[model samples]
Target: MRRRNVLRACLILLAASQLPSPAQAEQIIRMSTTYTTADSGLLAYLLPMFEKRTGAEVKVVITGTGKALELAKHGEVDVSLTHARPAEDKLVAEGYGVKRHDVMYNDFILVGPANDPAGIKGGKDVIAAMKKIIAGKARFVSRGDNSGTDLIEKAYWKQIGDRPQAPAYISAGAGMGEALTMAADKEAYALTDRATFAAYKAKTGLVVAVEGDPKMFNPYGIIAVNPAKYPGVNYKGATQLIDWITSDEGQRAIAAFRVAGQQVFFPSAKVGR
Candidate 1:
């Protein structure tokens, strides 16, 4: 009986040795995405589906698109999902990102108080609307956080050759949601992604003042951090995520995410970045 017990114990030890350790047994994909995606609860809605299909857990770090790309540049995250086409292209050109795949998009809108202090309501031209807002010295809230929206706002100011130095022009130095909230609280105008704006519109009581401009189009792209640069990064998992997100199932999931019965983000996997 003693000999039989010893053999059973040895067999169990061998079986355990054959099994992978905890770290090897499970995969974790680190991702950095824009605050809009996270705040709109899209990630919350879609991550579970991916996890269910792939059995790999996702660790998310939410910030602006600029910061998300920065995380990818440092190999701090295995992948990034962000909008900001210029910045995304730069990262890929600089060799930090392996490839960029078109994911989804939502246009930016000028949202402000229903009173329309800037007289930009229903404006078809964003440049003209911004000029009106500046001329009237209407209150405007800027994200001022080197975010994608901030970059676009700065470009608008540059186009008009005027910076908002007036006291009415406030810099929130925060994300889209916070900037929109600040705008709502102060009754100031702000540019925000449609998805986030829709999510917060009722709560903030802000209305879309300007939209449908060609330049208002916002496109999101997904990039897998180059594994060659950082071998420690989960390249395999990142690829899996990117492929799955661009697949039919992923596009369908994106289309399915809606805020208040209104579809905010549109699927762009079929389109090019």
Candidate 2:
């Protein structure tokens, strides 16, 4: 089916939700994502599709990856979709989450002011390039939050074995977009996922300085909270949402997602052959 037809159908089903019976009204699933639904027009199509199919209304909360994982740690939400791998691994190992599965992958790029002050644009090694930025004491902004990007940034810091100018390094405990804005304002260097970076690059005036180092690959995962750890958890509904998202149906919907004809996320779960 065409995207328009599919979206139209979802809109109709969601509109009917306003008149749903008591049973329908009681079925809801709270979903949390690091990125806002408004970041992608595809969200306008997804929220309703899931609701119509399972009679589970999706309540969306947008927060930084750190807080989103914390919400899961505390059993504050039913489902989570985020791109941070190390944090997700920690969450699962600690018995707070389960049903881990790879969903998508995007690259991370080191973007900096267009002046090329650190001359990091053509650096073959990302860590070496980072060392140069630190040696130069050039301004470097960090997402600081335990976001996947932040986790990776710290890992690279360890790799280089030197702290960038402490006072020069600004840790913005905010979302990816906000961090990019600050980086632009200060003409500083920051690492960002290609999807989010591309979404805001034009307005932020930041240019990609480093990429394809084999270490900047960003992979996203989806999972549910382990009900055994929290009895009140909606394990059944959470299972349903995961099954739907990884199903052929949901995979197809994701692969078809595009912004200005550019594919931002490559679906890990490919639809039927």
Best-matching candidate per lDDT: 1
Lowest-sum lDDT 10-residue window in model 2: 35-44
lDDT of 1 by residue, 84-118 (tens): 88899999899999988999988889999999988
Give the C-alpha miss distance for residue 158 in model 1, angstroms. Answer: 1.3
TM-score of every candidate relative to the true structure: 0.89, 0.83
In model 1, how large is the Cα lDDT of residue 113?
Answer: 98
Q: Residue 56: error of model 1 in Å?
A: 0.7
- Please identify model 2 stretches exceeding 4 Å from their true place: 1-26, 36-45, 270-273
Tell me model 2's lDDT, rounded to 2 decimals.
0.80
lDDT (C-alpha) at residue 183 in model 2 = 96
lDDT at 187 for candidate 1?
A: 92
